[model samples]
Target: MERIASVDEIPTKGVLFDYKEGPFDEQGILVRTRDGFKAFKNECRHLPMRLDDREPADIWDPHGRYLVCNSHGARYRPDDGLCVSGPCEGSHLKELPVVVKGDEVYLETDKIGGFFNV
Candidate 1:
């Protein structure tokens, strides 16, 4: 497990974190919802590209209800990483396992083997 962030560090806009998958460096997004904290790969379902590829850190829609892929306008649910609209509708974002321990969030790197095809 790798410590990613503290619970208090996650904002309404969410937090972007970096981790390693084998020798490759990858990014994940950590979000806090009504249910609890959720984490997902920064890649969009429609394509193997970062959701904020076009606009740095501009991952959320104007209303902040959904996470928007700036390149393709795909909107994903913050709580479940489900693409509800746009080209990737019916698809879900690749989720990264995360556990909150004593106010710190840890990425379950062991569970991520081969998931990212890296």
Candidate 2:
């Protein structure tokens, strides 16, 4: 994992940001969870499409509970990237470990896996 952006770089709330994990890393978003901060791969489990591929790159609802993929309106939990609705109901968003050091945010590339790699 390497430092990419800071908390300020990401929107205060209900905002999504695209982050890099490594050379072969997948695109992800840094979210502000009620417990703290978390990240999830932008790719959707239903297909190889990135959630942000839809018109709105960031589709977090006002309540900020889950991220909605604009492509097919799929909703996923930010905490663990679990799907709650849409075609991929039984699937989950690939979770990426993220660490916030001081004011900088780092994505943990070593543990990247789940729906995609499988």
Number of the predicted model whose lDDT against the real structure is largest: 1
Which parts of model 1 are misplaced by more than 4 Å?
A: 114-118
Q: CA shift at 109, candidate 2, in angstroms?
A: 3.0
Stretches of candidate 2 off by over 4 Å are: 13-25, 62-64, 112-118
Clashing pairs in 1: none
lDDT of 2 by residue, 1-118 (tens): 6665776877764334444444454566677777778777678898888876867666776576678888898888876778899999979887668788899777665665322221
lDDT of 1 by residue, 30-89 (tens): 898898889989999899999988965589888989999999799999989999999989
Candidate 2's TM-score: 0.73
Q: Among all windows of ten consecutive residues in candidate 2, which has the lowest summed lDDT?
A: 109-118
Question: Evaluated with TM-score, which candidate comes out highest?
Answer: 1
Per-candidate TM equals: 0.90, 0.73
Please give the range of 10 consecutive residues that has the lowest summed lDDT in model 1: 109-118
